[model samples]
Target: MNKASRSTVYDGEVTWQRIADEVGLSRQGAKHVYNKAILKLQKNEQLKQYWVDLIIEGRATKCD
Candidate 1:
């Protein structure tokens, strides 16, 4: 998803095909993985907050 967000291939958006190729999975498999990750993040509040905190820390460090 990060790669997709940063990609510029499809009019500034990356395709599932690109993600699949990078990860050695079929396009459908890549989509499945992405969906599964989203579900996990949604269902696990602690895990989600951990990542949110990490992102905030990363931004703070980057700014310094």
Candidate 2:
């Protein structure tokens, strides 16, 4: 699934461990994917808006 979709699935409250379990990835792998997805969104202005909207709407939240 796409990063945004995956992020939505857990209501944005997913930890790396949770992502690892759900996606069958290692913790580090999940972290890498999350970071990469954020970077990609940041680099593109249009996508950045979507990312910001998601954050503002509480569609995505940082994992503790």
Candidate 3:
């Protein structure tokens, strides 16, 4: 769900509804989940690398 949400929303593409559908959720539900996750990652020093890793992996996948 994060991957789907990030790929679309991060790229300025619409259709979070589609991602929510794929994950059996509403658009707001998906956004809420993602928002919480992002906030948590930003707040945590130890887990910050995980956020960076996610971004790197995402970019890598897009490049491929």
Candidate 4:
């Protein structure tokens, strides 16, 4: 979860290859873990509000 969270914190600029190497998983496996973490986060009400606040305050940024 730490590795996945760090990658997401960087706006996904970190590649799956790097995360996979660090976690001793294949690229696909790393992606799977990251996806699962995201699915869990999506269910967190506090996190949802945090994102909504960021968006409302114009502090949210996404990669093009």
| Best by the lDDT measure | 1
- Total clashes, candidate 3? 0
For candidate 1, give the lDDT of residue 11. 37
Query: For residues 1-64, could you state the per-residue lDDT of candidate 2 as single tens digits?
Result: 4565565644436678877877788999999999999899989999999878987776344543
Backbone-clash count (model 4): 0
lDDT of 3 at 52: 86
Task: Note the clash tally of each candidate.
Answer: 0, 0, 0, 0
Query: Which residue pairs in candidate 1 have backbone atoms (N, alpha carbon, C) closer than 3 angstroms, thus clashing?
Result: none
Candidate 4 vs. true structure, TM-score? 0.52
Model 2 lDDT on a 0 to 1 scale: 0.78
- Tens digits of per-residue lDDT for model 4, 1-64: 4656555544436888977977789999999998887777699988778867877675433432
Estimate every model's Cα lDDT from 0 to 1: 0.82, 0.78, 0.79, 0.75
What TM-scores do the predictions have?
0.61, 0.62, 0.61, 0.52
Give a tens-digit lDDT track for model 1, residues 24-63. 8999999999999888988999989987999899779778
lDDT of 3 at 3: 69
* Residue-level lDDT tens digits of model 3 in 6-51: 5654454657787677688899998998899889988998789987
Off by over 4 Å in 4: 1-12, 47-64
State the TM-score for model 3: 0.61
